[model samples]
Target: MALILLADVGSTWTKLTAVDSNGSIVGQASAPTTVGTDIMEGFNSALSEIRGQTGSKEYSIYACSSAAGGLGMIACGLVPELTGQAAKLAVLGAGAKVLQVYGYNLNEDDLKEIDDLRPDILLLAGGTDGGNKKILLENTQALADKVSPLPIVLAGNRNAIHQGSEILSRAGFSVEVTSNVMPELNRLDIEPAREAIRNLFMSHIVKAKGMETLSRRLAAPLIPTPAAVLAAGKLLAQEMGELLLVDIGGATTDVYSYGGIETPAGMVRKGIVPPWDMRTVEADIGMRYSLQSLVEQAGRENILAQAPHQEQWRQELDKILTYPNRLVSPGLEGLEIIIAQWAVRISVQRHAGSMERVYTPAGATDVLSGKDLRGMNTVIGVGGVMVNSPDPKGILTMDSKGLLPEKPRLMLDSKYIMAAAGLLAGSEPRVARRMLAESLAAL
Candidate 1:
């Protein structure tokens, strides 16, 4: 049978899925990520498992990766609020870990930090079409002095791209010029920058350490794992109106919200420029690797409220933190489930904007600063704990404290299909949509 293969090379585990050409999911397999050795070993193992299960070896593969700590990115813009924030959002929206963000022109300390961070790619954006050339060029020249070999995506003032490119090129840096991320005052255009980041992910990231062979074997451009998730989430939201995607992993809990038609008043009231999609990564709120930080951030009370044995669980977590690879008996599954609940609860709250009353000269008014997710209709859960848990729905019900989505239906990506569907979205949108609908149906 003709088949399509999709995989996500994640930090801890590599998930692989096989789908028939008709958009039906066929087989799914996973293996511990082989980061210590050749990372391709994990892929080989997963592919072999998939072939063995499906009883065939003939298939085309598409993949995305969050291995090697994913892609690290830094964006520099002229203004702190307008263009700079847009650049930062674009970087996050593209699934890169934000190493640092510089709103104003780069100084000595900033350059030193960028060099220390050693981001895989740097995004430089500022000004509108014909506005603010001085700061863009000033920032460009400053970058030329320090960031010698880094690949810079020049997405600033339209009029200054050429000059910026020339300066950076002369300084021995590779420059990819894209349209301004903030082409106008209240207009944010991030597609070009997002595409640039993806190109770098495929061209530079996947092939960086020792995976050249794996990179060459892939048929499609390898996307950042979060980007693939976002792509699949966006498509799902298109079909199901507004939707929220919660993915809880070992190291991070990522929330992707696709606000399609139904939007909160915050989008207009806060002067949000081109508000449609949002992706937030809560680094301190994961289940395994970040349990300590999660506890520190979410507080002990929040976790105990979920009905988990507190003291013994805390001791196990302490051991797990130090000896991460120790295969503990699976008796702590109850605590794990409670951790998942906190991950979803806090990550969603962080991803969403809050409504605050402002005391202005004109009567008191309310304003929002982030993407409001209260209007989303469904919360789709993806990951092992989310899909496997019997009461994933209960965890997803979210405490009634924050600006919660009212009566939103709960869905689960039971087949581990979100990342795979995201990888297939660009080439075979029909297959992606069909696979998502087939497996991730509402509960």
Candidate 2:
């Protein structure tokens, strides 16, 4: 049968899925991602497993990758609330990890931190269309002086583009200019900057990585894993109604929400309104590699409260933290499930919007910031924990305290097809949507 092949190359694992011409899943397999060596080593290994199941046949292929730390970037802008946040959101929407966001002008400490982080790209955004240009130029000069030659996407004030471009270009840094992220107060124009960053990621960063050979074999440009997942979430949201997707992985937990930005009744909106389709990656909250930090953040007492054998579970957790990749007896799997619960809970808490009681001279009022995800229609859980859990619904359940969906249907990405389907979204929307609909089944 004619078939389409899709792959997701992540930091810990490379997941593969085979889909038939009729948008039906055929087979799936996973192997450790060997980005440090040849990424294809793991890819071919997993491909061998797929071939074993489906037989060797000519097939179309598409791939997305979050291997080798994904696209790391540092955002520089004038004000913390205005241009700075805009710049950060632009990169995040492009599926990049914001290493740090610096407001005002760069300083010696900021310059030192940039060098230490050594991000793949620098997003310099400041001022409005004709607002403050001093910091825009000052930050550019600072970047030009102390920073190494790296790709820079300048999406700052339109008036300062020429000067900023000259500053970086003269310093031997390649700079890509786009429209201002925040042209007017509370008005965000992030698409241009997002596109610029994605273009830079494809043209410069991905091409330089070990996956370059693999990208040459793909049907289209290899995208970041999160970007593909975000695209899949958007596509699914078209049919599923307002939704929230939480992907709990070993190193990070990413939360994506769609079409819930409307202001709730009896509440005043504050801060920059997030995009309808939004994503937040909590780096410190994860299943394996970040388990220690996750447990610490979730609090030992909280974990101990629900854990079966508190002291023994804590000891086992310590061992896992030291060697995150080490597999334990299946009996200890309960501990993982407990951690997954906290992972979902804590990650979503950070991702969701919040309400605060503010007193004004007029009277008391409720103010909402970020997307109001309360009453979201659907919540889908991705990643291995959700897929393998015996009780995914239990893990997905959020306490009444946070601003999560109220009584939303829960689903799981069982075949790990979200990112793979997203790789095919541009080429075959029907197949991508079908795969997602079938794979994301109710628990």
Candidate 3:
């Protein structure tokens, strides 16, 4: 029987799934991601194990990577609400983590911080098609003088693109110019920027990570793991309808929503209307790497209220904070669950749109801001915490703000095949859809 190999090389682990041509998941394995050396070392180690289970050597290999800490990016725009947010959305959609999003010109301190962060790409976006050009000009000049030759994606005002691109290119920075992210106020044109970032990831970031060696072995070009997940979410939404996917990871929690939204009867939407397909990454909230930040956001008192043994849990929390990767004992898994609960709570709250009362001349009118996921009837949970937890569904049912589906069906990505299925979605829709249905049905 013909076989296919799908893999996701994550920061901490390299997971692989083997599936027959019939779309049956045959075997799976993983190893520590050795991006410190050659990434292929970990991949080979995992492949060796999979070989023992499936005894397959000749299979079509498809892979994506979140290794080398994924793609880090800094976005500069003219205004925080308009251009800045547009830039951020474009970066997130392209599967890059926004290290920082700066509005107006880049100051000395901002440049220094950018140096420290050492992002893979710098997305310079601001103004509209023919709007303010001064900020883009100033930021480009500052970047040329202060920043290293990191790739810069210029998606700002049409009036500034030529000058900005010239400034950066002359400074030895590789520049890709695309249409403005915000062509007009409240009108986002981010797809071109997103495509530019993805192309840079393939051309530049992959080489920087020394993934070129492994890229040659894949059936197709490598894609960012988060992008794969987002693709999978979109594909699944096509068949299953509108849904919200919450992916909790070691360092961040990413939420993706698909399908059109309906505004409440009398409520008016304020600010930018989020895309029908949208993704928001909560960098501060996570179970492991960002545990400290998660605790700080959830508050110690709030977290302790859920703990049966507060003092004991404090000591465990300290250890998890320090090591971040330390394995949790069976007895202490409850703490992880509690942490996961908060992670889900805080993340979904941020992901879901909110409404507030605004007194108008006529009467009190409600204004809604952000994506309204209330119409969603499905919530899919991925990540180690949810997959390993005994009560994964229970964790998602705690809708603190009534923003989630009123009574939703909760599904867990137990095999963590979302990314893998995503890698196949573009080329093998039948296989991808079957994999998604099978995995979700397993729950």
lDDT rank order: 2, 3, 1
Q: Pick the lDDT winner.
A: 2
Better structure of 1 and 3 per TM-score: 3
* Candidate 3 overall lDDT versus native: 0.86
TM-scores, all models, native as reference: 0.92, 0.95, 0.94
Scored by Cα lDDT, where does model 2 land?
A: 0.86
Which tens-of-lDDT digit does each residue in 1-443 have in candidate 2? Answer: 56888989888799999998778888899999987788999999999999999895667888888888888999988889888888888888889998999999899999999989999999999999999898999988888999898999999899998899999999999889999999887677888988888888888886234588888887788888888988999898888789999998888898999977888788899888788888888989988888889999989788867767788787888788889887655777777778889999898888888889899999999999887787688999987778888888888988766567877888899887889988887789999988997888887
Ten-residue segment with the worst summed lDDT in candidate 2?
A: 201-210
lDDT of each: 0.81, 0.86, 0.86
Ranking of all candidate structures by their TM-score, best first: 2, 3, 1
Model 1 poorest 10 in a row by lDDT: 260-269
Clashes of 1: 0
Model 3 alpha-carbon miss at residue 365, Å:
1.0
- RMSD values for the candidates in order, in angstroms, are 2.5, 1.9, 1.9
lDDT of 3 by residue, 98-194 (tens): 8999998788999999988888998999888888999999999998999888999999999999999999999999999999988888777778998
Off by over 4 Å in 3: 207-210, 400-402
